[model samples]
Target: MDFSIILMIIGIVCVVVSFFLKDSSKKIEKDLEELSISIYQETNSLKRRLKVVEEELLLEPNFQVKSPLPNKTKSSINQSFQLKQTEAAPAKNVKPINEILVRQVIELKKQGYTLQEMIKMSPLSEEQIRYILTNNGGIQ
Candidate 1:
């Protein structure tokens, strides 16, 4: 009796599985057919458009469209002209490097002068002096 009951349960599960698979397969087949039809329609439309373009090209062999340049404002044009003129002219107010001060800084550091003392005597910025000393193996 127990064996008969087990067999009956297995039969019911198999029936349920078969029903699910059968419905899914039909739905899949229907979707694939619709997709193929859509693809065919798009391909036909593209072919028609390409043929039209080819015909237009054949009718007018030298047909060309020129793209217009971007419009420039008056102020922008004036600014660009001024920029070119300024670039052509020599730059004024350029800072001159003080070679004497650089030499003095190196000399002071060689004499074991502390960074604070060097900053007090030199015209260089603290960061500039620190960079010089560190790069020249004068200080950590």
Candidate 2:
């Protein structure tokens, strides 16, 4: 009789412990469900905020609108810069440096010197010597 009574007490203790374990499992599941619902709500709020940002970006105004002005076109700007570079090149009556060289070659050639000979004796360019020979006393 004593052994049987001890067995019954042990069985009752096991049953009580099992009941408490089942209730704790239910609480854990309920907590997990609440966390899932809160996370879903936050994700939906973020999606709504993203849509509002997209709408704002689409409807916003641009700052660099075009305006009419005489100097705004490319041709007018280029013309202004070109006008600055051109300061009316000097008057044309004076003999250029090449003409002066040709005059020297002619004087030397008239003193009985061939072109090959003038080539060695004078510092005038070959084109100047040729111009002097070919022009026949005309001051080109």
Candidate 3:
């Protein structure tokens, strides 16, 4: 009445399945020996084939490793003593106003100056200072 009969039936079924599983596995051990021999022969043959291919490849000329200088004529390259001058781009010495202002603020702040003192040293007005400091998330 307490499901003990059902549990015992399930246990017997599991035991029967385990016995069948064990009996079935005895056949595979014989087959595994044959499988092992076949696997060994396959591996040995593959190794021999790979060795022959490697030896053949070693005999051939490796074209990729050749020096490219022999193909290019020496006269085609610049031989004249004229110094190779890189065209100088006239540099724009301009920096963003806000960046310069931020750098000045950080530098002045690092030097133990208050935010107002840094603002005073900067060329920007009170309004510009407020905006940059606020954007940069400085004091207020």
Question: Which candidate achieves the best lDDT against the true structure?
Answer: 1
> Over the stretch 1-140, how does candidate 3's per-residue lDDT look in tens digits?
65999999999999988876756556788789899999999999999999998776454422223323332321212111111111222343222233334445656665788667866798765544554445444431
Model 2 regions more than 4 Å off: 1-4, 17-22, 63-140
Q: What is the C-alpha lDDT of each candidate?
A: 0.62, 0.57, 0.53
TM-score of each: 0.38, 0.37, 0.27
Better of 1 and 3 by TM-score: 1
Runs in model 3 lying further than 4 Å from the true structure: 1-26, 62-140
How many residue pairs collide in each prediction?
Answer: 0, 0, 0
> For residue 42, what is the lDDT in candidate 1?
100
Cα shift from native, residue 58, model 3 (Å): 0.6
Which run of 10 residues does model 1 get worst, by summed lDDT?
Answer: 66-75
- lDDT tens digits, residue span 8-53, model 1: 9999999988877758777999999999999999999999999999
Candidate 3 lDDT for residue 116: 75
- The 10-residue segment with the lowest total lDDT in model 3: 77-86
Rate residue 20 of model 1 by lDDT.
Answer: 72
